[model samples]
Target: MFHLKKINKEKSDYYFMSGFTWLMGYLMIKCEQQKYRMMKIQKLYLFNLLCCLSTCTGLRGLISLEHKVYILEPMEEGNTHRLYRGEHLKLTQGTCGHGHNISYPTQMTNTTGHKRDAQSSTKHVELIIVADNREYQKQGKDVEKVKQRLAEIANYVDKFYRSLNIRVALVGLEVWSDGDKCSITQDPFTSLHEFLDWRKLKLLPQRPHDNAQLISGVYFQGTTIGMAPIMSMCTAEQSGGIVMDHSDNPLGAAVTLAHELGHNFGMNHDTPERGCGCRATVDRGGCIMTPSTGYPFPTVFSTCSKKDLAASLEKGVGMCLFNMPEVKVLYGGQKCGNGYVEEGEQCDCGDVEECLNPCCNASTCTLKQEAVCAHGQCCEDCQLKPAGTPCRESSNSCDLPEFCTGADPHCPANVYLHDGNACQGVDGHCYNGICQTHEQQCITLWGQGAKPAPGICFERVNSAGDPYGNCGKDAKGSFAKCEARDAKCGKMQCQGGANRPVIGTNAVSIETNIPLQEGGRILCRGTHVYLGDDMPDPGLVLTGTKCGENMMCINRQCQNISVLGVHDCSAKCSGHGVCNNNMNCHCESLWAPPFCDKAGFGGSMDSGPMRPTDSSGVTVGILVAFLCLLGVGIIVCFKRKTLLSLFFSNKNSTIEKLRKTLRIFFFCKSKKIKPILRPFIFFDIETMIKHDDN
Candidate 1:
């Protein structure tokens, strides 16, 4: 009296329901063979209700439904990595020039420079700053001014790098000049390399270590403004240097210096031409990689820049920054005296008497094998013993004399009475038998009065001569639970939806147990229960709906049409500044207006241009007149001797006055004359003309 009918559904749904009926019957017969008792078939409405809870609220919903239980399984795919930390940075700055002459001293003002808070940085980066400005020293440039300039430059650089865990310190300043002249103007990059080569050979007695990054600046009367070390930042080459011009603007100089060093640190310009994904232009203050640094400077590094820098570091670029004098070994450790081999030792065992092997040398924590001290397995007890050696089983079983024969001689193998032959032991079971046990047959149940099992429909006799058929626990052929023992039968799981089949032992579902959505139907493929419209595209959707935030619904689920936030104000706040949670751009300094546009903004608004006032104008004019009179008096006092000498020589003849002018020209023509005195001679003639005119 089991009646099967097709309900109103789609073509695929109808086929799925038909297959489900067959699958359910097969599972019930398979489970009965395992001696599982027939249980009352649960109503289809109960399983359908469980599906509704599982879909909307996840595992918690399934928990509320006492009949179904599920565990939250972690998906392996979508994991995010944390930022890099604890990298080391070593810094150096060397100022060089032509050997004999002093170059212009670059000014480093500590008071006027930017200083970053490196101590509060999360990344544990160690910084060391060293400098050598010998060329400036030889020419009598002001040492104090040079030191000030270095401090200022360091401050500015530290500010720029503080967020990156880079701290800068001024460690050493020394003069390193040789030869008569060393001008770097002709070819600054080439000149820097030559200077670096010379500097390496002349490292200070206390500075011979190769662990720190060498950053140097060369001062010279070169036509070139500045130059950085070639291949220093892009490759594994560690040492990098810059050529600096003292005459340049301090801000511009610092910026340019930072730019060159950035190159050495594996950063490129923020344009597609430089391999950046985004194009950096005047309008877009996206990054600092562009050639011209304008009014509103870039405040942050671009995503491309950060990614490339990380990639370069991961590729071993700039590792020379970690090479330091304090490091004792390539693989870092402490010496032997600190109660461990970590200080600077290969090994460190406690005492000589405690060493198990006689050859063990306690003083060095090594084995003296044939007069050679060995670190790895040096003692006899540490070495592997050979086979057939007489040994005790273990400390607990020392009384049993055992002969070692296996690969690990410390553990002896079991000896049989006969080799390659089976023998019956005293207990009568075949000992050391190579044969495997016989496979068990499937358990079959007899039909009551040949009416067949409660819900089973006999299909055919299986290959094992068992009457296998579509089976279930109930008379109506609806199963409370079903299980299939065959490998082809695999496993059954309960699935509830509009048109889906529920398969399992009726007791519990194993392997995977995902409940179906409210209106969603399920399809069984092997042991998997696929739910919803996603069953058609198993590859498209992983678990939930396959639609994105910016998608359109074609049928029931979403499909991608266009993406959001690509060119909107959200993309880095339109490149003006960092975007906050409220979706507004908080602009950086030198930037104004809403979008952070660079055209209208120049400098800070608070420090605008000043206009002349009536009172200030009168005061400025009076001060200028007073200064002019004082300058004339001082000129007459200092040039009296020259004026008197000229007056006596010109007093005799009319031709003497003309000869006096020619005499001045002859004085300038002489190379022996110092250039410093030329300005005074011109000033004296101008004063005499003014006096005669008056």
Candidate 2:
């Protein structure tokens, strides 16, 4: 019976071994199949990636080739083209009507009462280009061709603005193939008004962009090819321009578009009197802001344009330009050289030739090994800056500061006071991120000591519907009289400044003496600037100027600031914060965001935390985890005789292994290695288990 039992046990052991072997073989086969399948998927993925990259490269090359061919094509012979002189040219000659002289203050401080150093930062303009029906037809009724032309024009403008530390990113393109969205006419003034109104009412609501420009095929009256409001960038009322496609070559239209865009950026004509330095001579196109544009379209901006941009930025003229545009909305297909970091790209420092960043691999648009970041003010030494590090300081009263998050390389988008919020250090309220007051406008037109005149001046002067005294021009290009309530929203009347309007030589002073019932006469000084028929009169009151205690101007009407509902937005802030342009509560440093009632790091949801994360807790957690693991290993060794014996047999070896493992763990912790690499330490534990099993 004993012999039979022994034989049965042996057979059972043999069957168990066979079953184990079969299971092992099956697992190996399955693993091999999985490995083969994974390899095939990897190969297919690589092939698809290569094809996609090739397609993008081919499309970009085709576009470039088309652009080169079009540029090389000569202008139509015997066209007898009239001299393309823009009306803004009169600015240099002082021959046009009164022009607003935008003088830079001696002190380089912004309206927010802070020093401005905008040169150290870059600004981006999210631009949308629209083609009128006539322009679409001119391009052979090809929507794609019209889009290409407009894109090329935007590219040229972007190139011109690069020197000013500004980027013009084309976000959208609209081809008015069916018809013009707004009125287009030979009268440049009426056309500009209509286009701006349409842009504010229609385009702005549908597509959010920093600015829009209309490229038209219709010829403007006289020598005007383009017109834009000066120093009106990012404003809802006048942050747009109209450009006439006067030349078959897109470069000519690009130059005119750049000039009009410059006007929006607060740049004036590069007249000889400004003593502006131009690297490109007249034969090669003197400067982009030159009043007259002819052959060899100007590609470079003059020193004056750069200065104007800086001054405008300091004064918060282009407040919205401080934020980067959404790369996904960019018009052109993704390219490595476009400077925007798109999906699948770790970093982008511009084209390969222009890339000078040590942390970035420009060709592949990826960060170099060990680099966490390569761009933005919040990234330094290839690492993210600590939270609460100030990235963008408030530029003006309405502007808000942005801080680093310690998790992201880029700074947050800009924020500002809610519209209708009370302006800081000024009597007026915020509108479109600007604090416009009558006194401020007076100072801009006249020199120092300029102040808004008494009520009588505005009441009497704006009543007449003439060029010298009017609310603004009507749709028919005729002056419109201002009602009694809308008087302050019309032509600005001032007192005590330069003897004549300091704006320009063409500006004529209109003095009115209103005799009071008591006796003495009060002198009212008003300016009439003949800025040509196309441009809006700078002598008129600005759109956001305060008309009364709680009133502001809107479309030549005095409206209550409460229409913006700023009070309701502020009430949610719990008095510990202020309402930002996004309508979120920007909490104080000690309070949390979304609402300010919570006690935590400050800043709005749009911005980052106002304080750095605590590191002591992380250190403590790591130490505790290490202790727990050590305790578990000790307990396992005590509970298992095999493991305990193994440790006793090779004490020196075991100690040495433990030392090495600990060293690796400490090193990884010190370097802040990612969690994926932490599993490597467990291999040491596995080796010990294998030794015990053996």
Off by over 4 Å in 2: 1-71, 74-110, 612-694
Best-fitting candidate, scored by TM-score: 2
* Lowest lDDT 10-residue stretch of candidate 2: 21-30
Give the lDDT of residue 669 in candidate 2.
Answer: 59
- Residue 541's lDDT in candidate 1: 14
Could you tell me which 10 consecutive residues in candidate 1 have the lowest summed lDDT? 435-444
Compared with the true structure, the alpha-carbon lDDT of candidate 2 equals 0.72
lDDT of 2 by residue, 1-694 (tens): 0010111331121111111111110000011112210000011211101100111101110011111111222123331112222221222111111133444443333265554467778889999999999999899998866876787677767776887888999999999999998999877778888899999999999999999999999887667778888888998889988888887656677778888888898888888777899977776558777778664446678888888878777777887877788988887656564688898889888755467999999768999999999999899999999888888877778878899988888889888888887775658878877788888788877778999999988999899988878899776678999999999999999998888777766678988888989999998888887666767787888777679988989889899978888889999999999999898999998899999999977899987777636657867989977865664454345434433454576765665656554555565556564323335445656676567567
lDDT scores of the candidates, listed in order: 0.30, 0.72
The lDDT of model 1 is 0.30
lDDT, residue 89, model 1: 10
User: lDDT tens digits, residues 1-694, model 1?
Assistant: 1122323332111112222221110000101122221111112423212111111011101110222222221122332111111011111222222111101111111111222121222221122223344434533565443433443344344445544544332333333333212324344545555444444444423453321222234543333334443224312123445535332223334444555455555554454434554333345333544444432223335555555455434322342232112323211123221122333344444333333434446556554565332222111344544433433211110011223332331222211111111111111111111100000000000111111111111111111111111121123323212222211111211122212112211111112222345654333211122221101111111111112233322222223322212224335434554332123343444454345565322111211111223446868879866755554444445444555566666533423453454354444345233333356765666666566557
> What's the TM-score of each model vs. the native?
0.26, 0.75
